[model samples]
Target: MVNVGIGLAVGALLLFGGWVVTAGLATRSVSAVNAVFLSYVASLGIIGIYVLLARRPITGTQTDLVFALLSGVFLAIGTVSFYGALTRGDMAIVSAIAALYFIVPVVVDVVYFETNLGATNLLGLGLAVVAVVLITV
Candidate 1:
């Protein structure tokens, strides 16, 4: 299993690369929808290559597949919206707003997964919200 700190660092690095590519595409008069499609296609190719290198049998139950599909749908919608915002707004502000999406999963975990949200967690969430508000304003 990957260490959580390493996983998070890798994820952040990959996301930063994505944002740079998207920003470059945005400057080239690419429509947000088209940019999103292109990015997904590129991601698919990279993931395919990784799967090949890993050489593990891909296996999932029907429920897992359905959940994956649903998540993909939501991801597409969110990406399109984010790309659209990037085109029309300041990239820094747009990115700050987009970063706040973490709140959704936190809320979902607390409400549906019954995950405990301790005082520190709630304080961190509140601070994040305030930081974004301050950035946007």
Candidate 2:
């Protein structure tokens, strides 16, 4: 059977990739902060609607809430910075560097979560680095 989780993740990847390109293009006409603020507002409104339609309960433990708050803060900071970079720098270079952020999670998973990467995974990671380098230069 096809893995629904993997399929959804691929869908998310495509969606986010498109979002990056769209944001890069759209932010060209506005200040980075203004663009990011509007982006988040639109996202919040859309997600809020989805939650309401799905009757999704927004409930969590105290720790979960705290983590969620931190996540939001970090996301806002990163998004604003990314938009700023996109507006000020060549989009290809900015995006190549931005894509390297994936390394952080991989490191965290390997170190703290004791997760292991297969040979293929490691090869893919190396290839991604090479791809970014090629893109930037």
Candidate 3:
């Protein structure tokens, strides 16, 4: 359990670091579309190297590959959209608004996966939504 918690914390830190680098690159780039495309290509290269070095065999079904591809597509769209939003809107406002996406996955997990949304979780989710609303308004 301790290792799992540490792993999660490290993962979160890495994610934020990635986001910071991507956002800075997007801001500096002349074109958001190109930035997003190049970012994805860079990510693919890193992941490919990791897979090769780790010797993780790819055994996923076609459906799994399709879903993974779709996820990449969605990520590309999101990256472009976020960069565009940041260019047109205040950075703080755009980031706060984008944070609302947290609600979508939480709701989906609760509804589709029948995950247990305990009282504390529900309260936290509600507070997050409220914060987004307040920040935007």
TM-scores for all candidates: the values are: 0.84, 0.88, 0.78
Rank by lDDT, descending?
2, 1, 3
Give lDDT: candidate 2, residue 82: 96
User: In candidate 1, residue 70 scores what lDDT?
Assistant: 100
Candidate 2: tens digits of C-alpha lDDT, residues 1-137: 87999999999999988888988888879899998988899999999999989997879999999999999999999999999999999987998889899999999999999999999989989999999999988
Give the range where candidate 1 is weakest over 10 consecutive residues by summed lDDT: 19-28
- The local lDDT score (0 to 100) that residue 67 gets in candidate 2 is 95
| Predicted candidate 1 versus true structure: per-residue lDDT over 32-85, tens digit per residue | 888888888888999999999999985799899899999999988988888888
Question: Model-by-model lDDT, in order?
Answer: 0.86, 0.92, 0.79
By TM-score, the best candidate is 2
As for candidate 1, its clashing pairs are none
User: Comparing candidate 1 with candidate 3, which one achieves the higher TM-score?
Assistant: 1
| Per-prediction tally of clashes | 0, 0, 0
**Clashes, model 1:** 0
